[model samples]
Target chain A: MRFSVLILGNSSATPMYERHPTSQVVNHNEQLYLIDCGEGTQMQLTRYGIKSNRINHIFISHLHGDHYLGLVGLISSMHLMGRKTDLHLYGPAPLEEILALNFKYSETELRYNLIFHPTNPTETAVLFESKLLRVESFPLRHRIACTGFRFQEGERPAKLDIDKVAKLQIPPALINGIKWGLDFTDKDGKVHPSSELTTPAPLPRSYAYCSDTVRIPDYLPSIHRANLLYHESTFLHEMKDRAVETFHTTSFEAGEIAKEAEVGHLLLGHYSARYKTKELTLLLDEARSAFPHTDLSVEGKWYEVE
Target chain B: MRFSVLILGNSSATPMYERHPTSQVVNHNEQLYLIDCGEGTQMQLTRYGIKSNRINHIFISHLHGDHYLGLVGLISSMHLMGRKTDLHLYGPAPLEEILALNFKYSETELRYNLIFHPTNPTETAVLFESKLLRVESFPLRHRIACTGFRFQEGERPAKLDIDKVAKLQIPPALINGIKWGLDFTDKDGKVHPSSELTTPAPLPRSYAYCSDTVRIPDYLPSIHRANLLYHESTFLHEMKDRAVETFHTTSFEAGEIAKEAEVGHLLLGHYSARYKTKELTLLLDEARSAFPHTDLSVEGKWYEVE
Candidate 1:
């Protein structure tokens, strides 16, 4: 099984030559989830060769134009392309109204079902869950109501040992029980230990998307122990006042949050458009000073979650 | 003085490889007027090196997502870039409500003034006029309420013959009178004919943007005798049925409209994404069969009005 995240856009307010606004696609095994689609996301998906049809779940962190302005365009394109799969969208309550109003003006009678799941910006709860994955939302301190999403993969089943099964003469129908660490008794009443038959299952993996938020420690518990954490680093420490005023986080503050949450790796994105591609190293260096496991998020690059 | 139209995006519905959706900038003697901003209009403006601040007026032809979805993003970018000039936007009535909702959600307090002018899709009328140019709107037959725009240059000032002025020893202060086609007189009361001192001004240049429209004859009088006419040619003669069903036009019908309207030159655009850059020549050839002066609109190309 493989789990990864693809960066669709990393720029903050404005989209530049190679840097667009905040958007990314999370690939959990083969299932796809999109987060924070900015303008030009469909183009970015084409640029990266990701099939838009594979994305059934789209999680938007906020209602800022940079974060979700691309929603309508993406949906419109999907509708034009004759997509028939139901789309699940999770965001603020006003987002539903916004989408409805825009659709009314365009007179777009969507061909597929569009399901809206409103997220409370001031509470923590499980937003979505399936057999293989679970998504949780936590409050963030920002100018407007916003939330961060945590993607947690379900615990994988134990791998089967074909050789051991054959040696034990286990029935084919009982393989699932054996894989679940069940002991097998032979016809002659000989007992076999479950631990000796199967190895332990792999622990679940998790990723957190925390962006467009001020440096606040209240949400640390919700994001604790994430395998990979992507936090917004919109400015340097020199612009701390501006960051505080704008309800955005500086690189140092992002690092401190990552360190406090004890995340395995910290990926920094939502860079201000003023920082050129090569110039963003200053932000990385600032974050690394607080947390050594910090890395810059390059657009269109995919990072694996271990 | 220069009057030209820059093709920013030419593809219909879906934005493909090199062609984007409907967007163009009409440059009337350096005053830029934007028509139908698509999803990447801001990026297109940046790519074509047209300063965004230079655009003061924008006209959206319809409420389709591909036509005006980018307006809010463009305006937001302008505000972020510190644009202080008032922006005038003329479009469908719902556009104002949509912008208001989006701005409210984004909490954007624009630093500059934004004025909205609503258009009625059922009538032909002068939508905007200034000292240099006049823009008229005419209804277009489509699935939804739509209209086409005609950009007509104001009556040009008469050009003065510098040699004639110097030979006649006319004062520099009276050159304005000569340029205005007023007869020049000396102290001896001998008058010079306006035609003798000044050449007749070139016929007022005009360009008509008739896109996302079917080949309906109702708009012919509104766009009669334009120097250049851009008509939507979404399909070929083979897909005439599809064109009629979608309320689009075939290339042959586009040519017929051009021929009937007596336009100086016909530029066909808003092509279906199915036509590659090389395949569009078939459309041009087909259009030329009905009107000999038809040309394909190449993206990023600027066509002179005269």
Candidate 2:
């Protein structure tokens, strides 16, 4: 299983020459999950060559334009391309109303089933669960009602020790059972312990996405120790006061949250348009001072979590 | 006056790799008018180096997502930029409902006044008028209530014949009156006819935008003899059946309409994504067979009306 995040856009409020707004795609196994689609997200997806048809679920943090503007276009395109699979959309209630009105006036009847799941951003709840992963949303502090999502991979099966299996002349079925953490029982009533024949599975990996929000310490418990954390850093340290006033976070503040939460790696993004490409280094340095694993999020870049 | 149509997006239904949905910026003098705002219009504006602050009015053809998905994002960006100028939005009534719900959920108080002018696409009405131009909407045949707009320049002043003015030793004030189509009178009551002093102004230019509509002969009366006509050509001649089935027009049909309307120049655009850039020549050729003055609408190309 591969758990990773592809940054589609990383600017805030308005798209600039240097950066875009908020959009990310989380790839887990064979499925793709979209988070907070901003303007030009479909273009970003095209630029990265990510198959948008593989995306079955979309999680929108809020009704803010920068966070969800690309959604209707993406949905409309899917229908035009003859997509028949059901699309699950999770967001605030108002988003559905907006989408419905447009569809109503356009006389557009979608070919696919659109499922809407409205959530309260102040509550912590499991949004959906699949065979390979589970998704949950928690509260975040913002000017509007916004939520953050946590994606956790399912537990993995044990790995069989090939050398031991060959030395013991074990059958393939017995090795499979051992890998499933089951002891092998022979016809002669002899039993082989699973632990002795197989190695333990690796720890399950998780990723948390915090977008368009101020630094909220209360979300630490839900997102703590995530393998990877993507947080909005809309401004540099010098704009800390502006960040607070606008209900956003600085890169340094994002790094502090990641360090306090004990996340494995931190990806800082949602940069303000005022900073050019050259000034990104200043933000990276400021963040690295608090979290060494912090890295600036660039569009089209993918981060892998092991 | 500069009468240029900046192609913000030309893709239809769903956004594709090289094409965007319907959105164009019509630049006339110092004012910028948005014709149809599709998703990612703001990014397109930024990419094309258009100043978003210059836009004072937005005219939506219908309630299709591809036509107006970018409205909320653009409005939000204006608020974020602290824009104090009032914006006039003309679209179907449902658009106001959608925007209202979005503003409520996001808890956004726009710093500028967003005047919503609900349009009855089924009727022909004068929508807006300014010192430089007048805009009126005419009925268009589509699946929904859609309308096309005609932007006509205000009446031009008569041009002064410099040699005649110099020979007659006419005062500047008298020249101004002559240009205004009034006869000049001297202190001794000697009158000079305006026609003898000045020549007629060049015909006032006009541009008609027929976006996302099927073949409609009824609109010819309203847009006849326009200086330039921009019509949506979503498909080619071979896809005539498909165009009719989807309430869209092919390049051939667009050219036919332009020929019947006796438009000075026909501009064909809104290409389907399935066709490559190389295939655009085929579209242009089809249109030229019927209307020799037809031209393909290319992005970043500017058209000036003299």
Candidate 3:
């Protein structure tokens, strides 16, 4: 079971100093899920050798150009690459019309079905669910309507104790029930508890993505105690006034949010273009002051959720 | 007197092998004019140290995603960078609505005026004209409505013969008239014709961009005698059938067009992803076989129109 997040782009506002705008990939069980597809995202994916066709679900945090401008190009490329599978997109309600207008002007009839799911920024709700994963979106404070996403792994079945099963000679028919926490009875009518037959399941891992927003308390419960948390830090503590004016968060604010939510690890990203390559460490240092477990998000690097 | 074309991207349909979709910069008198704002164009401009603010005009050939998807992102970046100058955009009639919808959804009231000028692809006509430059658009045969752009230098003023002016002791005020082809009459009643007093102006240079189209004779006259001709060579001659079906040109066909138009030099680009880096030579060799003065368009290289 692999659960990790790969940073594709982390720069905020404009692409400068070889850093692109906000975009990343959440890899769970080898399946790729894209988040916040900023400009040049397709190129970033190509540069990192990520298979874009594998990305079935794409989540846009908002309608800001820095967060979702590359979406049209990426969809067009999927069509050109002969993709026949359905693509699921979740974002603000206006995104559906925006995409439709773009496609209408281009006169493109997509070969694959483009299924759009409009996200609600008014409340926290489940957006997607599969056999192993559950995705949720929650409200975020921003200049426009925006939402944050949380990916949580489904509960795993209890593992069978091979030695105990062999000694007891448990029938194959009862094995399934035993793993599901069902008790078994012997010929003598003595009940054998399922807890003794199997080991407890491992804890499920989760990751939360919050971007293009200022510090807010509305979504804290949704992202609580996530194994990994990626929060937008568009400015340093020195530029708190600018961050407030723009409805963006500072590095220290992101760290404070992670601390308040009690998340396992805080991943800082969406840095402003004003911070040079060497100056990024200052942002990291500022974030670390609030949360000691904070780490800077570097493009193309995978941070596993443990 | 500097007139050149810089290749920012040349890949057709999709971005692959580090080459982005169709985009290039036409520089005349140190003024940058963008042609075909493909995805990642702003990043491309920054990569080559080209000032994005210096580009006041942008011309998109068609509504294809690869041709104009980056337009919104570039425009947004300009706005974010605090641009106050007006931006002139020339493209299909529907493009204005598309941009308006994009800005509306993002709620972005641009800081600068975004002037939109619709182009007609059915007929060849001058799209823009300045004191030193003239840009014209002509129809191209494609699957959709497409146009090609030609950048030509305006007629230059005649150069004054310094030796003749000094020997004749011509007044400084008369020099301007003489340069404008006015005759100078001496007090003794002998007239000095402007042709004899001034040297003839050098030939004005021009560059033509024809892309995402199949071979056609409709616009040959518009690009005739261009100092540099950038023609799309999306496929090799071996894939002529595929080229014809897709309304794209093969290397041989592009070369044929250059030779038929009697252009000074042929710069071939818009290569298909099927051609690997080492295999691009086949396309170049095929085109060279038809036109000896053909050169492959390399990204970041400036081809002078001389």
Candidate 2 CAPRI level: medium
Tell me how candidate 1 scores on lDDT: 0.90
Over the stretch A108-178, how does candidate 2's per-residue lDDT look in tens digits? 78999999999777889899897569999998888888999999888876878889788778887566668
Which runs in model 1 stand beyond 4 Å of their true positions? A162-177, A183-194, B168-172, B186-190
lDDT of each: 0.90, 0.86, 0.92
Interface RMSD (one decimal) of model 2: 1.5
- lDDT for A15 (candidate 3): 89
State, as a TM-score between 0 and 1, how close model 1 is to the true structure. Answer: 0.95
What does the lDDT read for residue A51 in candidate 3?
85
Candidate 3 residues lying further than 4 Å off, grouped into runs, are A159-194, B159-198
Candidate 2 local lDDT, residue A180: 70
**TM-scores of chain A in all candidate models:** 0.95, 0.94, 0.92
Worst 10 residues of 3 chain B by lDDT: B13-22
Give a tens-digit lDDT track for model 1, residues A1-306.
789999999999988877888899999989999999898788788889998889999999998998888889899888988999999999999999999998998888999999999998889989889978999999999999999999998877777766788888889888787767778898999888666777887888999999989988888988899999999999999999999999999999899999999999999999988888999999999999999999999988999998
Alpha-carbon DockQ of candidate 1: 0.73
Worst 10 residues of 2 chain A by lDDT: A171-180
lDDT of 2: 0.86
